[model samples]
Target chain A: GAGVSQSPRYKVAKRGQDVALRCDPISGHVSLFWYQQALGQGPEFLTYFQNEAQLDKSGLPSDRFFAERPEGSVSTLKIQRTQQEDSAVYLCASSLVPVGRDGYTFGSGTRLTVV
Target chain B: SQQGEEDPQALSIQEGENATMNCSYKTSINNLQWYRQNSGRGLVHLILIRSNEREKHSGRLRVTLDTSKKSSSLLITASRAADTASYFCATVPGDAGNMLTFGGGTRLMVKP
Candidate 1:
């Protein structure tokens, strides 16, 4: 892949339905990040991964949000019991740095609409 | 919980006019980077200014940082209609890996 790729470019879920979003980062990139962007706001950091380790989940809004990077390559963000407020664009980004440097490449993002 | 807030939540400018957006953050940052997004799409990295640097430029884009005041500004000169988009500022807190906290962003509309 030339850049980070996100699956299900758009998702419409019933309020309370569970939804899963996927991300495929560039090959060998060691750092991955997930963010949520509301209609008029900037992307809010949700979680981050360094290889397979979830070092930071502090930004996950609530228990309904969960993200995982199982093989240090692909990642998934699952939201349980989706609410109207959960309707937003989910972005995935990847970077390569032993210490995670100054550059990041972002995916097109999945637009989720909770009905 | 918005750490970084950009002033002028929205702006409208003529196609050839320049646009400037300011961002203010609350905490000590290792670096501040600017990004641009169109509609609800993914953000495109614009430029990065480290805590130690005062200003940087890339083509028509000029970035100035005032870490003392926890603020930064992005200037786009000779702007085109295509340059009209939401601009954001993101901060990486104190050498933390790749995690970034972003600002609310400024939405700009350039009319022809």
Candidate 2:
């Protein structure tokens, strides 16, 4: 792909429902990251992956939140029992390297709404 | 937790004017980067400055980094209406890691 791609540009889920968001990063990108952004705020780090390895999951809000990049090319973020506070945009980004030397290319994001 | 804080929550300027946004961060950082986001869209990387570098420029954008003070600034020269967007600053910690912590961001509106 020419750029990072995300699925389900918009999602509406009832409280307690589960939702999954997908990200297809730019080809050959070695690093993938997930972020959550609330309205009027900057993106917050959720998780990070170096290829198929989940190096950092410290940012995940709870155990219910899970992310996996099985093939190191595409990734998914699944949230279980969504809460009202979960209403926000979920962003996916990828970096050619480790992001220290290069900035990330981001997806438009999936706006998840929990009512 | 957010590592950086952008000053001036909102800025309004006429098209042809220069717009500047400031960002301050806590703790040491390996690099600082700026991004632009149009309403309802993803962020686009603008520029990145390493801790060892004092300043960098790309096209109409100029970014300055002061590691001693833990601050950075983004200046847009001859802004256009199309330049209106929210600007954010993100930092990668000095420690080896890929996660980038972002600031609250500054919303810039360029009126034609």
Candidate 3:
């Protein structure tokens, strides 16, 4: 693909429903990142992946938030028992190399609404 | 826990006028990057200034960083209505490898 692609551009879930967001990074991108952006706020880092390894999950807000990059090419972010506060735009970004030297390419993101 | 804090949370300007936004951070950083978001969608990387570099320019965008003051500013020369968007400053912590912490952002409205 020309750029990172995300699925389910918008999702409306019940407060207790579970939702999954998918990301298809540019082919061969080594680093993948997930972020949560609240309305009127900047994106907050949620997790990071290097290939298939999940090196950092420190930013995940709670135990209910889980992210996986099984094949290292595609990734998924699943949130269980979604809450009103969890309603936000989830962004997926990928960098060709390590991120310090190169800026990331972000997907359009999935806007999740929990009511 | 955002590392950077952008000033003038919102700005309104006419096309052809320059727009300037400022950002301040708490801790040392390896580099600071600027991003633009349109309609609450994806963020587009604009420019990056390293800790040692004081200034960098890309097309109409000029970025300045002062490591000593832990601050950075972005200047857009001859802004256009298309430049209207939310601008955010993100920092790579000095010790962290690739993680970036972003500020709340400055919403710029360039009126035609």
Candidate 4:
């Protein structure tokens, strides 16, 4: 892909419903990251992956939030029994390098609205 | 918790003027990065400055970092209406590997 791609640009889910957001990072990128951006706020880190390995899950808000990168190319963020507080934009980014020397490429994001 | 914080939650300026946004972070960092986000869109990487470097430049953007003060600033010269967007500062905490912690961000509005 030319850039990071995210699915379901917008989503509306009931309070208890489950939602899955997908991300297709730039081809051959080795690192992936997921973030949640609340209204009028900056994106907050959710999780990080180095290829197929889930190196960090410390930022996941709760057990309800689960992310997987089984193939190391595509990733998904799943939120179970979504709550009102889950209403926000879910962003996915990928980096070419494992460290901070190179910047990341971001997806347009999935805007989830929990009512 | 967010590791960085940007001041001047909102900034308004006219085209051709210079806009400056400041960011402060807690704890040691490997590097600092700036990003821009237009309304309802994803962020675009602007510039990055490593801890060892005090300043960096890219086109109309100039970034300065002061590790001693744990702060960084982004200066956009001759701003344009196209530059109107929210600017954020993200840090790679020395202890946090590749995960980046972002600040609240500063919203800049450049009127043409």
Candidate 5:
């Protein structure tokens, strides 16, 4: 693809329902990252992946939140028993290298509403 | 947590004027980058400046980084109505693993 792509541009879920968001990063991008952005706030890091290895999970808010990039090309973020506070835009970004001096390309994001 | 803080939560300027936004971070950073986001849209990378470099320019954008003050600024020259968007600053911590920490953005509105 020409750019990073995310699925389900908008989602409405029940407070206790589970939801999954997907990201298809730019071809050959070696690093993938997930971020959550609240209304009127900047994106907060959720997790990071270097290829198929999950190098960092410290930013995941809870055990219920899980992300996997098994193939090192596409990734998915799953949130179980979603809460009202979880209502936010889930962003996906990819970098050609580790986010050092390079800028990341971002997806449109999945606006998840846990009502 | 967010490592950077951008000032002037909102800015309004005329189309032909220049707009500047400032950002400050709390940690040693390998580099600083800027991004823009229109309402309901994804972020678009603008520029990146390495810690060793004090300034960098790309087209109509000029970025300055002050490692001593742990601050960076983005200047958009000859702003246009189409340039209206939320501008953010993100840092790659020199000591931490590869993750970009973003700041609360500055919303700019350029009137035509």
Candidate 6:
């Protein structure tokens, strides 16, 4: 079975530039999540989607971080006006349900470097 | 925010030796889970122990949770070089969703 997948394993952008990270969740998985992990730290939640409907965005650092999952399977996390503070790995995960009885499967993530 | 804290921050052990890592959290949780990451990229789910269940085992991996202490421990018996990676403990509280709060992981290096 195909697990979650992310594109452009690595990206480098200049300050003030915008970047987009993509995630492909497993088929029929209703719950999707985005997280940001800085160097030597645990991942922090960004947003969550259930069947195309975003349930939470409180973890988003600021307005510059936006996510969308139109088809309920594919998701995108876009960061605007990149900053060195934004340099980190963005992780995507999906699970069968929201209550989390079944653990999530994560992608390799995209490492972004803002110079 | 990191849901829990793990220590010793880094550990070095040899093959055939036992490796132990500990984690502690502040909030009430439905379950606690462990994950392993290699090179800090993708993380693989290792095990999950419910708050009510004090201990659970999968093969050579043993996870023990102490609700009163709000802590958990992961013990690997006869570790291998493949076990060298960062291990994290995630606390899934009663947030109505499975959103996890992870901790700063413990880096384990196994010298074979």
- Top-scoring candidate (DockQ): 2
Across B1-110, the per-residue lDDT of candidate 5 in tens digits comes to 79999988899999999999999999999889999999999999999999899999999999999999999999999999999999999999898669999999999999
How many residue pairs clash (N, CA or C atoms closer than 3 angstroms) in each of the candidate models, in the order given?
0, 0, 0, 0, 0, 0
Better of 3 and 5 by DockQ: 5
Chain B alone: TM-score in each candidate? 0.95, 0.98, 0.97, 0.97, 0.98, 0.96
* DockQ comparisons of all candidates to the true complex: 0.63, 0.84, 0.72, 0.78, 0.82, 0.78
Local accuracy of candidate 6 as per-residue lDDT tens digits, A1-115: 3999998799999999999999999998999999999999989989989889999899999899999999888999999999899999999999988767768899999999999
The value of fnat for model 3 is 0.64
Q: Model 2: per-residue lDDT, tens digit, B7-83?
A: 88999999999999999999899999999999999999999999999999999999999998999999999999999
- What is the alpha-carbon lDDT of model 2 when measured against the actual structure? 0.96
> What is the per-residue lDDT of model 3 for residues B1-112, given as tens digits with 9 covering 90 to 100?
8989999899999999999999999998889999999995799999988888999999999999999889999999999999999999999888866888999999999999
Q: Tell me the tens digit of each residue's lDDT in model 4 across A1-115.
A: 8999999999999999999999999999999999999999999889999999999899899999999999899999999999999999999999999866689999999999999
By lDDT, the better pick of 1 and 4 is 4
Q: Give lDDT tens digits, candidate 3, residues A1-115.
A: 9999998999999999999999999999999999999999999999999999999999999999999999999999999999999999999999998756668899999999999
CAPRI category for model 5: high
Among these predicted structures, which one has the highest lDDT? 2
A82: Cα error in model 5, Å: 0.7
Q: Write the per-residue lDDT of candidate 4 for residues B1-112, one digit (tens) a residue.
A: 8889998999999999999999999989999999999999999999889999999999999999999999999999999999999999999978658788899999999999
Q: How does each model score on lDDT? A: 0.91, 0.96, 0.94, 0.94, 0.95, 0.92
Worst 10 residues of 5 chain B by lDDT: B91-100
RMSD of candidates 1 onward, in order:
1.3, 0.7, 0.8, 0.9, 0.8, 1.0
* Model 5 regions lying over 4 Å from their true place: none
Tens digits of per-residue lDDT for model 6 on B1-112?
7879998899999999999999999999999999999995798999988878999999999999999999999999999999999999998885575688899999999999
> Least lDDT summed over 10 consecutive residues: which range in candidate 3 chain A?
A96-105
Q: For candidate 2 chain B, which ten residues in a row score worst on lDDT?
A: B92-101
For model 2, residues A14-82, the per-residue Cα lDDT tens digits are: 999999999999999999999999999999999999999999999999988999999999999999999
TM-score of each prediction: 0.96, 0.99, 0.98, 0.98, 0.98, 0.97
